[model samples]
Target: MTDPFFLCTLLWFALSIAALARLRRRDRQAIQAQIRQVGQLADETNELILFLDYSAPGFKEIDAFLLTDMPGRVTVVFHAPQWLFAAKAKRWERHCVVSADCLNASSSGMTPTRVVLDKGGKYRVFYEVPAFLKLWSRSKM
Candidate 1:
């Protein structure tokens, strides 16, 4: 038990465990902050922010929307819906992947911009439809 090799290995293991615990705590706090931001945005907008799968093949929709927007068009950024306050944020973080068809863009007469949060809650992507094409693309979405 007094061997230097065993002592060194035990010390390394203890340090590694401490480092891992610190990293985990940091990650948890970051996730909480992200959730708070999302919740606040959702509350302010009072609109449903559509969540999409960033890893899918059809994720090009956000890119298309970005390209289609006119250079002069104004942009608006809004947050999540009321239901996402705090309790449901965890569920949302766990299960944000959803089909685009879940939303009916035409019912509102205007195509509302789409908001997507990354799975890690580290980034947000917004897809704004152009004013001219709002009606035109309303049926397409």
Candidate 2:
């Protein structure tokens, strides 16, 4: 009968819609679970140390940049605050430029200074007298 055919088509359409909805829901939940796992790991790490090259635009391809800027390579150790533990680490590097500069200057030694960076954009600079300072001073006299 025509009624049976119409009923079958309608049922098939309803089942397809339900299946698509279930797949979407599962996908969303899987994404959320991944996010939570990353957050947990970030919390445990406390701090992240990233070696960077100041000559380059950003922290892309560590080996290539290191080879090009071998003389000017720097190590950036980022300390994520407790509050920002849940925040992703990748975003911080992109948004923060001052931190990068501090790291660059510390390693380059063009300036005899060391910088300490903390959360909320706070930093301190300390002068590091070269190890041979006393000897050099004696030689000057």
lDDT of 1 by residue, 15-60 (tens): 9999999976664564345345545544432122343334433335
Q: How many angstroms is residue 117 displaced in model 1 relative to the true structure, after the best TM-score fit?
A: 14
Highest-lDDT candidate: 1
Q: What is the lDDT of residue 47 in candidate 2?
A: 19
How good is model 1 by TM-score? 0.36
- Writing each residue's lDDT as its tens digit, candidate 2 over 1-141 gives 469989999999999999999976664454334323433433422111232233333324433322343232223333334333224234343322223222212232222222222233232232232222233234545
Per-candidate count of clashing residue pairs (backbone under 3 Å): 4, 0
The regions of model 1 sitting more than 4 angstroms off are 44-141
Candidate 1's displacement at residue 56, Å, is 5.9
TM-score of each: 0.36, 0.32
lDDT agreement of model 2 with the native: 0.35
Give the CA lDDT, 0 to 100, for residue 49 in model 2: 22
